[model samples]
Target: MTGITISKGATVIMHFSIKLKDGTVADSTKVNNKPAQFQVGDGNLTESFENCLLGLSKGDERTFELGPDEAFGQANPDNIHHLDRTKFTAETPAEEGSIVVFTQPNGAEIPGIVREVVGDSVTVDFNHPLAGQTVTFEVEILNVEGNE
Candidate 1:
């Protein structure tokens, strides 16, 4: 295992920070001094994102930036949906930033975060909150191996 030796099914622990296009911190495991662990190619991280760590081993740290297309891609206008406030109940508070779960016709439940509330209409955006934004990833490779 010479350079960047990680492989499929490898378990890795990493400290990471994700910054938005505005340079606002979106998420960081390092803030709390805790690291995240996950198996490679398990669909938790995107292929492009995981590819960045392919051969990195323990104690390897790097800061990389990926463009909007490679990151979350441009935001989609179709993801915006308007729903009546009557759809919400006391048990489920309807407010901006509240995640509301709506079931599809096929019985699969999907969640949308409330973006705005006006009169009787509540605007919910189904797109990833980070969608369309260029992002910077600061990562520290804690461990790497080919063993699943």
Candidate 2:
């Protein structure tokens, strides 16, 4: 490990890729030639995911796999809601397998995928797209800085 290792409160700049079980790339920071910057122990990342960065330093490359429980988590049935077809606008039709954004009472927008559309009812799943799937994380650390 290098002197400035990744730990709680450390800032990290890195490129990462998330792959599914079939080796299909789900997401990658390299897509737009932009790396991600974040501080360790931040709520933006799961505790298990952050733990994978512990002791890593600049110029390090690492890969790890996380199960659903440790990653996006299992899909919750309660998150699936059925709404009337009238609730959808023409611009955002309830098409199966399409993702749609809905505004909550608090004004926060959330994305849900249309699972089915039957007659006057539309079923939408609000779970994270990758929920319940195991994923592999590959990270290349470009820089690491200790907390000030």
Worst 10 residues of 2 by lDDT: 1-10
Looking at model 1, the pairs that clash are 4-55, 4-56
**Inter-residue clash pairs, candidate 2:** none
78-132: candidate 2 lDDT, tens digit per residue: 9999999999988888899989999999999999999999999999999999999
lDDT of 2 at 50: 97
The digit string of per-residue lDDT tens for model 1 on 22-134 reads 88999999889899999998989988889898878988889899887777777898999999999988866679999888899999988888999999999988887788888
Evaluated at residue 111, the lDDT of candidate 1 is: 82
Residue-pair clashes per candidate, as listed?
2, 0
TM-score of 2: 0.97
The residue ranges of model 1 lying beyond 4 angstroms of the native Cα positions read 1-4, 103-109
Best by lDDT: 2
lDDT of predicted model 1: 0.86
